[model samples]
Target: MRLFGYARVSTSQQSLDIQLKALKNAGVKPSRIFSDQASGRNADREGLNLLRLKVEHGDLILVKKLDRLGRDTADMVQLIKEFDQMGVAVKFLDDCISTEGTMGEMVVTILSAVAQAERRRILERTNEGRLEAKAKGVQFGRKRSVDRNKVFALKSQGLGATAIAKQLGIGRSTVYHVLNNP
Candidate 1:
């Protein structure tokens, strides 16, 4: 069975050296180590893409942390399911997370469920808070797109919509809205 490792950092400025060291300690070869310096929000990362393509049945993919695998629990769970179907094993060194056997599957599932539930609860609480604020007549969202008097002044000064947008650091659409509606 082949052993491969994947490492990632949110930005190019961050170092992958720590993860690489951990993967190497886990026995993954230097040649088989794939890395990407991109955000987890991006699904088509270079290193992750190459690893998925290169890994075969009976191959094991090692990671320093479970978060290195994907952005969220749902995303990681889906990826794990795909790897399990392909007979590729994924092992998270930090969390002892694996998708190899029945016990491993149970652990991953339980953890994923707990995470998802927590996210849902947080969302519900945030929405409730927003609703309560709205009931008290709280204004939300971006306060008026642009300064009203400024747009009028710029227009009176013979500046075009695009120019007003650039000068105020607002969108051209906002400039038009302020000019046309007023």
Candidate 2:
């Protein structure tokens, strides 16, 4: 069975050195390493998708941690189920468990539940923050454009809305508003 390693970092600014080193030290080959610098919340990460496509029956998919697979536990469980259905084995090195056993199943279930709950809590807090902002008369969308001296100068030069928009790097609607409002 081939051992495949997956490593992920949430942002491009971060390095994959640690995860790659850990996977290598765990006996995974360098050529078998698939790394991606994308958010865990993204489902279509390049390296992750490649690993999924490349994995075959009897292949072992190794991850440094459960969170490296996905941020949402439900998603992680679904992904694990996909691997299981494909006859591919998944192991979390840090967790020290193969997802094919009874204890592993329980752990996956509990982790998935916690991840879903955490996602729900985040949504609730975001909604509350938006509601508070609205109650305080704060604007919730893009800032409104204003008529400025530059618009007057451009208009005085016989520049049309389209020409002014092109010159100012703004929308035609913005130029029209400025011309009509001023």
TM-score of each: 0.62, 0.71
lDDT of 1 at 91: 83
- Model 2: lDDT equals 0.84
lDDT tens digits, residue span 1-182, model 2: 99999999888899889889999998899989998988777667888888988999999988887778888776787888898898888888888878887788678767767766776898899999999999999887767655478877988999988898888888888887777776
lDDT of 2 at 81: 88
lDDT of 1 by residue, 1-182 (tens): 99999999988789999999999998999999999988665567888888889999999999887667666666767788888999999988998888899988778777756655765787799999999999999999877756899999989999998999999999998888887898
TM-score, model 2 to reference: 0.71
Which candidate number would show the highest TM-score if scored against the true structure? 2
Stretch of 10 with least lDDT, candidate 1: 111-120
Query: Runs in model 1 with CA error above 4 Å?
Result: 112-182
